[model samples]
Target: MRVAHLSLGDFRNYRTAELELRAGANLILGPNGQGKTNLVEAIAYFATLRSHRTSSDTPLIRAGAGAAIARMKLEAAGRDVLLELQINREGANRAQVNRNTVRAREVTRWFSAVAFVPEDLTIVRGEPSGRRRFLDDALVSRHPIAAGVLGDYERVVRQRNSLLKSGRGSARTVEATLGIWDDQLVEFGSQIMLARRELVRDLGDPLSAGYRALVDGDHGPALHLSESVVDTLKERGVSRETRAEGSQSNVELADVSRETLAQEFRDALSAVRLKEIDRGVTLLGPHRDDLLLTLNDLPVKGYASHGESWSFALSMKMALATLLREESPAGDPVIILDDVFAELDSGRRGRLMSAVSEFEQVIVTAAVEADVPREWDWNRVQIRAGEILPAGEQTSGTPEPKSPADTDPAPGESLSTKDSEQ
Candidate 1:
């Protein structure tokens, strides 16, 4: 699916803006700080429900505004779907599909997108949390219902942690309530772990091919899950390894039953119960697991060079995008490259463009026109000082300075409030 149009009001630097997109190779070009990433971030927000750059929604709201409005008209399989979001600064966010209000997570069921940003390199080089997020986001893209499951899992963890902290009650009382929480935790966490295992297994082939396409030679890129439960099982007499260190070291998760996994999960919790009670935290389960990315039998985080890390991260995203394309009846998920071409060498830039060119739609943001490959017929939009400039308007050199008239909203002007007033 592709976004046919995007509308913004008080989002980032845009007070009010409208952008028309096309089926293939749409480019957003302007100098840095001219809102290039913000536009694509708005589009991607519908897919992931969070910003790639920040963890909080407050920053997404334009200063002095109570809420930010983002609306998009999408086209897929000979039909159009309208998706809208109002990101509030104080209250919960709101969502709409085809003008009908629904739960915010429901918006993801209608659209899918794979965004490649500079921060992706962190997935390989950064902490475990980033890698965990990558896995969860991939799961949600593969099955939108997974959003609810993830939400449930997170809530269970929170509630369980609260109970652990309040162990002031009688020991029997605490144990009784804790057992109920444990059951819910295992029920949801097991589903997540199993789904993640399947995702990693399915992504292996595409990830290998994607990496090979981007770089020369076979580096033997591979994925494995370093599961906490599996480790606990090994401590007992399960005889299964979590890492894909070698043929014998890898656990064939396909053959592993959820009943087996649930038992292992319970065992893990029991082993850690005392420590968890002392620390007042829920320490074992999917939240503690990690996706171990490796290249040529070595961990990518510490062993891979800058170039190799980029290739792995890019390949991972491409693998997920390919999986979504093959499975979704909604057509290809919109491929978004947000200022990514600038970071890659010329060869990889061309190769990356060629790799994604076959998709139904691609949206790219770049600060320099020459950074993007020039062969394709690109539908280009220019931005300056939060404004979508007309064709023939040059946006080279530094971003134009914003004047007061450009920054300030007119009297009685607010997208969220005005719509309600109408």
Candidate 2:
């Protein structure tokens, strides 16, 4: 899918700005603190229903303003679709598609976008929660039903935690209540586990391949879904043999059936009830699971150098983009690269540009115009003090349109076409 146009009103630093995008690459050049990122963030918000940078929606609204609005016209599967998001601090956020109001979930049905920013390096070097969030977000975008499973799991976790925190109840009563939560938690947690496992399994090969390509075929990265329940149960002598005979099969972590996982979850919660009561929190479930990233079998957190960590992060983003392209019915997801060009060396930057050029559309933000590939057909938008210049007046550079063959090239294909003389 490609965004044909975007309009912003009272959003961040943008007072009122409209942009028409090209099918190939659209470059947003600006210095720090300008509104370049805000423009892309608006498009991404329409795609994912959340901001990639901030968790709270308040900052998305322009200061001194009460509300913010973002409108996008998208072209997907040869059809034109319109998506709009309105956010007001004191009021409910609203969304619409094709001039019709839609439920929050239905808005996500319109488009999918994958973003790669310099901060994404945290996905590899940061805490487990971030990785888990990344997994869930990707799952929700690809399989909308996965959102229901995640929501259910979170609700159970919250209720269980609340009960643990309210120390006014008797032990017997608490245990009974905990039992109910455990059953529901297992039901939803198992679904989440099963969905995550299958997603990782499907993404494994593509992830490794994408990593190799990003690093110039020099290294392979491994993604492991680490689960506390699976590991905890095995420690408690719950043999795979006994578990396999039940409804769900006790296979590998990625292949563990939801029913089997639910059974294991129920058993683990029962065993850990005393410890949980003492700790005042629910400790053992998908909520505590992690997505582990290893480079050549070593954990990337402290072991990998800065450059390797960046590669792993970019690789993961590229893999997500590729996966969305294959799975999304709307078509290829629009790619947003935010201030990442400055983080890569010349070689890696070339590879990343090569990988991104294959997408239907790409919006990149950078401070240096030289960072962009000169050969690709690019539409440049220069931003200064929250103001966007018209395309022709933005840069001395002229528009260079990539041939159809170049614009729609297959993945891993070389983009070494002769530079168009502008």
Candidate 3:
């Protein structure tokens, strides 16, 4: 998919701005805190429905503003589609497709975007939650239904935990109530598990290849889906029986039914009731599951060097990009590189640039132009103190013409001689 245009209103430092993107590579060059990342964040919001930088939406809105609005026109599969998202401080957020109001969840059906930021190194160096989130986001983009399943699982977890914490219900009463949630949880959780398993299975080959290419084949990398449910099911012989079906193995879970998993879940919960009661929280579920990344049979987080961690993180993201291109009907998803070049060596940076060049479009933000490939035919937009000016204008030492006070001109705006004469 290609983003045709983006309009931002009251988003971060951008009071009102519009940008038109080229089909290949678009560069946003700027100093720190100049809202370059904000533009990419707005585009990413269309895909993931959340900001990557901030936990709260309030910070996304301009200071003292009530809400922020992002409008994007996307070209996907030979059709023009419009996506709109409005973030409000108090009320529910609003989403629209083709100017028609739709549920927020429906937005994913139209667009998919993958972002790679410098902080993504955290996936390899930081805590497990970050890696898990990386996997989950990629899965949700590929299978939109997975998002709903995740939401259902989280809801069940909350309700189950609340009941466990109430402390008034008898063991029998709680068991019955817990049984209901366990059934739903296993049903949804099993689907989530299977989806993740399939994703990791498919991604492993590409991830390994990417790692090898990134590091010039000096190291071998492996991606593993570490799951509690899969292990538990295997220990119970369910996995063996399922595998007996040969090519139809995955179908067995659906055929034997969620009821069976639910029964197993109930038994497991019963076995752990005393311990759970003591802890005051639900402990064993998909919510606590993880994705393990190993390089030569060692965890990347504590064991991998800084360069190795960067390679692993970049490989994971590149693998996700490949997956999206394969799965999305909208062609290749737009790539956002947020100051990631600063951390990479010349060879690694060239590899990343080469990998992303096959996509329909790429937008990168960096402090130095040299961070980008010198030969890249990039339409450079220089941002300083939240104002964007074309590279030619900035380099030519000509003052950029003032835009209409209402809306900023799209990227690469030029100053007209007539206006200068006036």
Candidate 4:
């Protein structure tokens, strides 16, 4: 999938902006606070309906505007899709695809992209929440339908937590009502756990290969899908049924079925029912899980050096992009490198560039033109104070900004110069 053109209105610092992109590589150049990251961020948000930089939608909209609108001309599987999104501050966001209104979540099916940003280092060095988010994003990228599954699971958890909180005083009533929420939790949560375990299993080889290629070290990178239900039982010394539960005698996670997971989840809830009511929360589910990343048999967070952590984070994203290329109906995902090259050393920068150069389209943003690798044929666009000016243009701050672009440039006119020596 590729974005042929993008236009933003009342989004972040951009009152109005538009740009036409190419298939190979598009380089967006600007100094700090000029909306370079904001431009790429808007493009990525169209894929995930969320931001990587911040957690709130209020910051996404212009200060005085009631809403923000983003529209894209996407090319996917040889057809053009017109995707429009309206993000309102006081109401639910809305989306339209091919001029037909649809749920905002439904827009994910139209395009896909994998972003490599400096913040991705959190996957290796941060808390379980970050790793879980990494897992969920990869799950959605692999199967768009998984997004709905994730939404259902989150809703069930939230509703179940509300029931647990409000009905705490009456033990009998709480138990009875909790049984219903337990069934739904086990159903949705078990499916999520199964998918996550399978994803970690499949990522093993690719992550190892990518790490080996990126870092000239003997450390072996491995991913372990740590489940709360199993770990809780293990901590309590509760032995699981071996061969009777549709698993091998040892009950390896890879061999467990959804039914096996559901049964275990149910048992776990039964064991911890009273404790959960006391705490006003739901436990023993995929939401409590973590993706354990290790290097040389050690956890990467507290043990690995800074360089090692960066390499691991980069390898994981690269491996994910590679795996999805094999699974995606679209031949290649739109790769966005947002101010990432500046953070990497020269050797690592060259290696990273070589790793992703083969993709059908790559978008890179840099504060200086020289920071980006100069070997490729780059379709360059210069952003000056939230305006998409032609390449090599510069300006000081203007008193009154122009309205967002009414239309993008003609197809071929957006490129300042196309590198000819492929």
Candidate 5:
């Protein structure tokens, strides 16, 4: 997982652009309101297909443009892969891998990326939906096949919710149709829940180690999956582990298998059927789960100071990157730091840089050159209002006059290491 080249058209702020990239630390620097974030956003969008900044795709397309196109040449595991996406406005988007058309969701299988943005702070204090999304993203990255599993599960949940909301027929008629959806939900949802639980289990040790590196004074970070179905099983009775074939007296997240979770999902849905019908929504599944973050036995969201919260969030992202690096077959996933250095103090900034500097590829964006450490030997790209200057050439359309980036390589130009020197 490294990107060798990238080209963009009508994406975010860029009308037409192309740039060659290296496999080490590549920095994109510019002022605020410029397209620095947009540059990295396109890189990451190839991996997850979801924007960290927004929930919709409309903003991704340039204003007044019918569609946007992004193409990339990637090198992973000793081979080169070309990935392309057509981001349309009215109908479904299209995707191509190595020039062959495939389902849009299949685009995620080709690239693996994890991004650390200022918005990542929301994962700590935000709603459970954000946390669940975080889990699913990691799961898909870890096992690309999970994309299909998650897609089917979400479709089942949506269809089930629709039926619950619009049902006005006889009890038997509604119950018969609901059973079909319930079975599909259990089948797909179990795989999602079990995979998420496994990831959280693996994250506990690494997350603790990462936090200690970022912060001082003996603060231990902990991650726990707050699953709705598991809690419900406990409230109904008591036990540590229960087989799926038998009644679920208790749930053990770490040891639970897909078959066992599917059984519990069926039981949980059965117990909540009346309530679900009344509320007109599906409840008691992975969609309702949350990933709990704790520091020294206390939750970080509402109790920890602002610094502690940021530490917890950073550790989570860093820990996920570490896990992927360990498990990836050929190389580590591309790590993107989108305008993140400005938000940190000096010590944390150094710690963050040291941790990621050794990766196969790391892309950083910042408004201030002083914020990034000078020891990095960084390859710099100067971006201003969607115009990119590689390293040694200067160009027009720069937003700020007499800025630090006024003397850098212009667009469509090849750059050298000497060009990046101060």
Candidate 6:
């Protein structure tokens, strides 16, 4: 699906802004600190419901503002859907679809986008938590309902951990109470684990193909889940060592039934019960799992070269986008590259563009016009100090920041602008 229009109020640096986008390539060109990333972040908010830049929603609302308003007009399969979100600084966020109120999580079901940002390198080079976030985010994008499952699983983990911490010195007293949490943990955690395994299994082929397309070498890119439940069943604390030793590939998780996984999860909890009370933490669950990204039999985190790591991360995203395109009824997920071309070499930049060029829509943000591929006739828009300028506006020299009155849409005026002439 393509974002036909995006409107923002008090989001990031934008006080009030409206951007009109078109199908195929659209480029947002601006210098540093000019809200290029913020623009795309707002569009993606509907898809993932979280910012790629920050872990908290407070930073998304402009300073001194109580809430940030983001409204998107999307088109797919001859349908138009309007998704709106009010990100609050203090209270629960609000959402709407086609002007009808919905549970905030419901907004994700209408839009699907795959964003490639500079931080993606962290997926390969960073800590296990980053990789876990990658898996959970992909799960949400694939099936919006997975968002609820993830939320429930996270709640279960938190409550279970609380019980574990409270029972630190009184194991016998809290044992019965802990059993209730354990059952809840297994119930929700097993669903997450099973969904994750299915996602990893389906991503295998597309990931391999994408890696080959980007690097032109089959470094044999692969995904392996170092599941806490599976590892605990094999041997205590095996999942903890998966990263350091790079032997996570040995864990087999594909085609495991939920009943089997639930039993294993229970066994894992039983295996770690007393130790968990002593440690005051839930020792085994999806929360502790790691998605081991491998290239040519070695873990990407410790062994892959810088270039190889970047390609693997990018390929992982492309693989998800491909999977979504194949399964989604709404059409291909919008491909977003947020200042990503600037990070790649000339060869990879062209290759990356070509790799995603066939999607229904691609929106790119770049500080320099030359960083983007020039042959596709990009629909270009300019941004300056949070203001979105009209189509084809030149930004070669530093431009004075426009006042809010200059760009804000007039009351009842249409936000739609003619598709910028290529």
> In candidate 2, what are the lDDT values of residues 1-422, reduced to their tens digit?
89888877778876677677888888998888877888888888765667878988999888887767677778899998877666766656666667566555566778888888876988888888889878888887788767667878888899889998775334655776777787888888888888788777777777887877878675668788778886777677666553453233213555655676677788777677777887778888878999888888899999999989999988888888898898877889899998898998888888888988999999998988877767777788887666777544754433342212222222112222221110
Encode model 6's per-residue lDDT on 27-119: one tens digit a residue: 999898999999999988888889888998899988988878788888988898887777877767877677566778898899999999999
Report the Cα lDDT for candidate 1: 0.84
lDDT of 3 by residue, 1-422 (tens): 88888877788887777677878889999888778889999998777776778767889888877767777888999998887677766666777677667766677778888899987987887777887788778877888767777878889889878987875435654666766766777787777766776787778777887787788884767776655555554555554343453333323433544445555555555556676766657866667777778888898878999999999999988888898898787799889888999899999888888888889999999988887876678877778667767764544343443322234323222112111100
**What number of backbone clashes does candidate 1 have, counting pairs of residues 3 or more apart or in separate chains?**
0
Worst ten in a row by lDDT for model 1:
413-422
Task: State each model's CA lDDT, in order.
Answer: 0.84, 0.76, 0.74, 0.79, 0.79, 0.83
RMSD of each: 5.1, 9.6, 7.5, 6.9, 7.5, 6.4
Off by over 4 Å in 6: 236-252, 391-422
Local accuracy of candidate 5 as per-residue lDDT tens digits, 85-131: 77777667777677566776787888889899998888998888878
Which prediction has the highest lDDT against the true structure? Answer: 1
What are the models' TM-scores? 0.90, 0.88, 0.86, 0.89, 0.89, 0.90
Q: How many backbone clashes does candidate 3 have?
A: 0
In TM-score terms, candidate 4 sits at 0.89
Model 1 spans with C-alpha error above 4 angstroms? 168-173, 236-251, 394-422
Specify the poorest-scoring 10-residue window by lDDT in model 5: 413-422
lDDT of model 5 at residue 261? 74
Residue 207 of candidate 1: its Cα lDDT? Answer: 95
What local lDDT score does residue 237 receive in model 2, on the 0 to 100 scale? 67
In model 3, the runs with Cα more than 4 Å from the true position are 168-173, 230-267, 394-422
What pairs collide in candidate 5? 391-409, 392-409, 393-408, 393-409
Question: Relative to the unseen true structure, what is the C-alpha lDDT of residue 387 in candidate 5, on a scale of 0 to 100?
Answer: 79
Candidate 4 per-residue lDDT over residues 1-422, each given as its tens digit? 78888877788887777778989989998888999998889998887778888876778988888777787888888988887777777667777777566777788887788999999999898899889988888887777778888888999999998988887755675787778878888888888888887778778777887887777655899888777898776666667774233323212666688887888887777778788888888877888998888898899989999889999999998888888888888678889999988888888877788888888889999998878887888999987766787697665654232322344322122111221110
Worst 10 residues of 2 by lDDT: 413-422
